[model samples]
Target: MERSKTVRKGTAYWILGVFAIIWAVITLYPFIVTIFSSLKTNDEILGSMLNLPRDPVWHNYYVAITGAKTLHTIMNSIFLAVCSTAGVLLFGSMLAYVISRKKHKYNKIIFTIFLTGIVLPIYATLVPMMKMISKIDILQPNAFYTLILIYIAICLPEGLFIMAGYMRGISRELDEAAIIDGCNTPQLFFRILLPISKPALATSAIITFLACYNEMIFALLFITDKAKYTVSIGLLYFVGKKTTDMGPMFAAIILTTLPMLVFYMLFQEKIQSGLTAGAVKG
Candidate 1:
């Protein structure tokens, strides 16, 4: 009976291992195609996507970076993502801390209001928001600030949910200890709580950054200047009315995807732990 059970367990392991390999191949196939396409001529891509490049067209990358201004747009995306993420983390964490720790009659109501923002479709408000942006003199000069504020608002609800859960898990005695040490509320938050909430903050930051980085519709609507275009907007340069530069476009996509792929690979562990810890503690 023991030998039979052992054989069954080994068979199950082999089946799972085979499934895992198949899934990995399915997930990675598109990326492999993109990389191969980037190195091929337009004719080569149209001829056969799976076939290796006849002679790698290294110039495609050069055209993508210079002709399409890929690097400049990537920089624009980075700036927007970093600034918006910072604002979301600051405001979201403050609100989360208050609602989670403070004794207040209206805490639940306030949280529900923010939660409503999550459920409400962003498309429903786009027309009104566009009109509002046009009327505001401050936003007329630069769309970056406008985009940052919008990202912060959109990301805040989810950030609050994650942070509040994590904060609730923390012992209230820490707050008392800080108070006894003559630390003010700001000090307690900045010095004690924020440091302890690194995992939750990291999770929120990653999500907010990626959202702002990849967001195209709002960027396309708000930004008119070519110089201010984000990576999503920049990718459109390869598409022309007459003929699309498929090779250069594929190269541009590869360049754009590399940074985000590297980022997620680095922080994937933190993301999992943060969600797990927050869920358990809350």
Candidate 2:
């Protein structure tokens, strides 16, 4: 009987291994092609997509970084993403803490509103938002602050939801202890609650930052100035009215994608732990 069980388990492992290999190839093949194509000339790329390059052009990277708007766009993306993530973390956590801890009559109503935000599609509101912003004059020409505000609004719902769920798991006894020790609301939050909620906060931060980093449609619609464009928008500039520069475009693509890949690799373990820790308790 034991031998039969062992054979079944081995068969299961083999099946899973085959599936894993196929999945990896499906995901990684495009990235491999992009990297290899970036190292070839436009003529070589046009001649044959599958053939190896006759001579690898390492100058693509140099031109992408120095000759194009790659560096400026990268900085813009990082700045917007960082600022928006910070805003979401700060205001979202505060709102969650209040809703979770307070026993006011309106707490349930406020929670319902936040939950509604999660269900609503952002694209549905874009036209109304554009009209309102245009009327308010805040959507002035070349303003990045407008984009930042939009990011904060879009990210707040998920940030608050995650934080509220995490806060539910924290002990109420800790709040009572802090109150007895004469700690004010800010002190209780910053010193005690925020410190304890690091895992959940990190998870929210990563998600918010990535969202802002990759946002394209709104950036394309709202931003017109070349100087204010993010990496996502800047990449589209590689395609001209007449022709597309495939080599430098791929090089730019690789550069834009590498940072996010590195970031995910660094925080992937922590994100998994955060998700499981908040969900499961002894």
Candidate 3:
């Protein structure tokens, strides 16, 4: 009986190990190919897709960073992502705190309206958004601030939802105590609630920033100036009407992805904690 059970457990372990390897390959293959392509020259990339580079060309990294347009694009992307994240966190959290703590019929209505934004597909509003942008003339040409506002608007729903859900888990006793101490609404949120909800805040900030960083369609549609283009838009410039430069394009792709990967790696623990905390409480 013992020998039979041991054999069965060993078989299960082997199958699980095989499946893990397959899953890793499925998720990681494209990234591996991108890294491989980034190390090769255009000619080498065209000649061989599967084979490793004979002589690794490291200049692709230099070209990606030192190129004037690429440098500008990187800065634009960083500014948009960071500013949008900040706006969403500050505004969304405040709105969420009010809704979660206050007992009012209008709060429920406002919350529902904000929640509706999540259900609506952003692409469906493109025409209207573009019309407004044209009328406002703020994002004219390639202004980074224009993209920042758009990103903040797009990210608000999710940020609010996550924060409100997190606020539900917080004890009401804290609010009562703050009120007893003569703290106003703004003081209560900034001093007490905001510090305690750091996990959720980090999660929302990272997600919002990444969304703005990776956004392409609106960036392409609104941004006409090369200097104001984000990394996503700038990376596409490597492709021509007739042919695509696979090597440098891959290098640019890797460069664009590296920041996000690093951000995730740095804050992965906080993200996981925030997600888990929200899930468990909500």
Candidate 4:
């Protein structure tokens, strides 16, 4: 009976491993196709997308970098994403710490407000935001700064949600012990809580950065200056009125996607931990 049970478990494990491989193939199929497509000519891609390039056109990457100026747009995205993500993490974690630790009558109300923000669709605010930006001359000077602020505002709710949940799982005994050791609020927060919250912070940063990097509608509408285009807006340059440059476009996408892929790969473990955080009470 024991041997039979062990065989059953082994069979289940084999089935799960096979299913995982199949799922991974399904998930990576399009990305693999795009990478191959980037190396092929437009004609070759159209003829056989599933086939590997007969002779890889490395020049397509050159066209994407030089003609489309993809590197410039990537730099712009990095700046915006970094700045906005910093803002979201700083403010969100501070607010989360307070809401999670402190006792206040308005705590629930504030949490509710942030929860509502999570529920609200950012696209719905585009018109009103555009009108507001139009009226505010200070916001008009630098579109990047404006968009950074907008990204922070929109990302804060989700950041707070993640951070606050994680923070709540932390023991209040830490806070009390820190106070007993003569540490002030700021030190307790910065040195104690923040350090322990690495997984949550990494999780928040990844999500916030992705939102800022991939945001298109606001970037397109708010930023009229071609020089300030984000990666999402820059991709549109390949589409012309008379002709669409498919080869260069696919190359540009691959170039733009690499950084984000690397980032996720680096922090994937932390992100997983953060997602499962707050599940068990300590």
- Residue-level lDDT of model 3, residues 1-282, one tens digit each, is 999988987989799999999999989987898899888988888887787988888887777776635666777889888999999999999988988888988997898788788777889988987888888855564677777788888889888888888898999999999999999988999999999988778878867777788899889988987668888889777666333456666777887778778877987887666556544533
Q: Over the stretch 1-282, how does candidate 4's per-residue lDDT look in tens digits?
A: 999988988989789999999999999999999999899887888889899988989999999889888998999999999999999999999999999999999999999898788777778998888899999889983478898888899889888888888899999999999999999999999999999998789888877787788888888888778788889889876556334557788899999998888977887776555445422211
Candidates in order: C-alpha RMSD to true structure = 2.8, 3.2, 3.0, 3.5
User: TM-score of each candidate?
Assistant: 0.90, 0.90, 0.88, 0.85
Which of the two candidates, 2 or 3, achieves a greater lDDT against the reference?
2
Tens-place lDDT per residue, model 1, 169-247, is 9999999999999999999999999999987898888777888899987888888898898998888655563345688
Query: Relative to the true structure, how large is the alpha-carbon lDDT of every model?
Result: 0.87, 0.84, 0.81, 0.86
Who wins the lDDT comparison? 1
lDDT of 2 at 144: 82
Candidate 4 local Cα displacement, residue 57, angstroms: 1.1
Error of 4 at 44 (Å): 2.0
Mark the regions of model 2 whose C-alpha exceeds 4 Å error after superposition.
139-141, 238-244, 271-282
- Deviation (Å) of 115 in candidate 2: 1.0
Q: In model 4, which runs have C-alpha deviations exceeding 4 angstroms? A: 1-22, 237-244, 272-282
Show the lowest summed lDDT stretch of 10 residues, model 4: 273-282
User: What is the RMSD of candidate 1?
Assistant: 2.8
